[model samples]
Target: MSDDGRQPDDPLSRFLHGETGALVFVREVLTSVLAVALVGLLLFAVSGVWPPMVAVESGSMEPHMERGDLVFITEPDRFTPEFAHGDTGIVTYETGAAEAYTTFGEPGSVIVYHPPGSGGSPIIHRARFHVQEGENWVDRANPDYLPATSCEGVPACPAPYDGFITKGDANAEYDQVSGIAPVVKSEWVHGVARVRVPYLGYVRLVFSEAVLVQIDGGADGVVPAVGGERVSVTGSERTTTTGVVGSASPTLATGSAHGTPTATA
Candidate 1:
């Protein structure tokens, strides 16, 4: 019997008194988990999204964003800019350029969006421009970013029912042109990247990679997504921005720079 009139081996008493090594360890773990949960809840309250942070798995964004960077993201409607597009609150590169607005050092917002029918993680790229359904967007595209001369040759041309064209900063081609993703519908957008913390995301990346290797019987590699599965975006000079497509789980978005430039997140 314990001095306090409780059985010495009583789990509640032992845990309360820190008398059992295993119980103490369990308490510590629970405490740590609770703390993490609180922090996540706070972030969600502010960001209006679950898992408000993401790790950059590739260098598609390059000088602006990099692999191992931890990026903070908020729902698109959380902080709508004055120059934002319609109710989406996203400013495309075309509009940002004209308005002198910028994110990650260039015009426009860096957005995390799930491409239609991808069934993978979301893609993190800059919104280059908006197009209406059936509209020929080729004329508005930068010739340097397009592989084809006309709308007929481009893969996602004619707007695909209203969406944004995206690209990684370091890539030579737009995501649509390189087959990284199709049009990014406004509803498909998950969040907008606001800030980046360098090198902190490596922890998540390493942990996630290990789990994936065990589950899928594949080597640890980072494509994009919140889980261990990755969609490979391999290329050096030619990057392609794709989702689970290394984007991460459909529920969470991971980031990378893909272009034939080879960026995937």
Candidate 2:
């Protein structure tokens, strides 16, 4: 033992108690920070084609995906859908196509993206079909649906759409009608949901105060501790900002390219 009778490697305890040498403590802290930053940069370098993960917020996906799930996302270029024919296990859709939209044991690809003009956070939903100027998207999933024939009845696009239309699995209307607008382009698209862990996100929610119980009159996010000190959450929708829930899945996501920055859920 040293003159202080402490192990040389116990930097954390020393730093916390203001007992370590100034240079030693600074070195230890910088070393830790740099190591973490390096790992993050490495993940970004490889998986930046699409964000590797997203936290589920709302119940829009229901039955299949639920709130408080951590969804592992894959790069659009590397994501493959299990179609009616068979599974390719490779990247299929790159840019939007005129026809032959793919599915994941359903009607559309579950996509994560940001709206062009809304300036909102990234949304995770299913991409039903890719449409050009005059193409008709007949929903096999919904047989009685009718096309708007004009932007008048559809979600107004920033420009004319040459991309895919998205929808929430549990929602009554498509994203366009749901106020998220219609026509997501190849550029706006980010990750596709691949695998999800059930309710594991509650741990994050608990610590981050994303999970809450109603307090007094207003619903506040707080966890009461032994001495009655609570981790309180206030004045924000952050409880739902980056949501986590349950869903079905096997592996994490695959990336098509690298360096793209995906937004928070």
Give the candidate number with the greatest lDDT: 1
Summarize candidate 2's per-residue lDDT along 100-190 as a digit string, tens digits: 5644344445766665554423566666655665544443224322235444444443336576665655555666554444566767766
In the order shown, what is each candidate's alpha-carbon RMSD? 8.1, 10.8
Model 2 TM-score relative to the real fold? 0.54
The C-alpha TM-scores of every prediction are 0.75, 0.54
What lDDT does the true structure give each of the candidates?
Answer: 0.61, 0.43
Local error of candidate 2 at residue 114 (angstroms): 0.8
Clashes of 2: 8
- How many collisions per candidate? 32, 8
Q: Superposing every Cα of model 2 onto the true structure, what RMSD results? A: 10.8
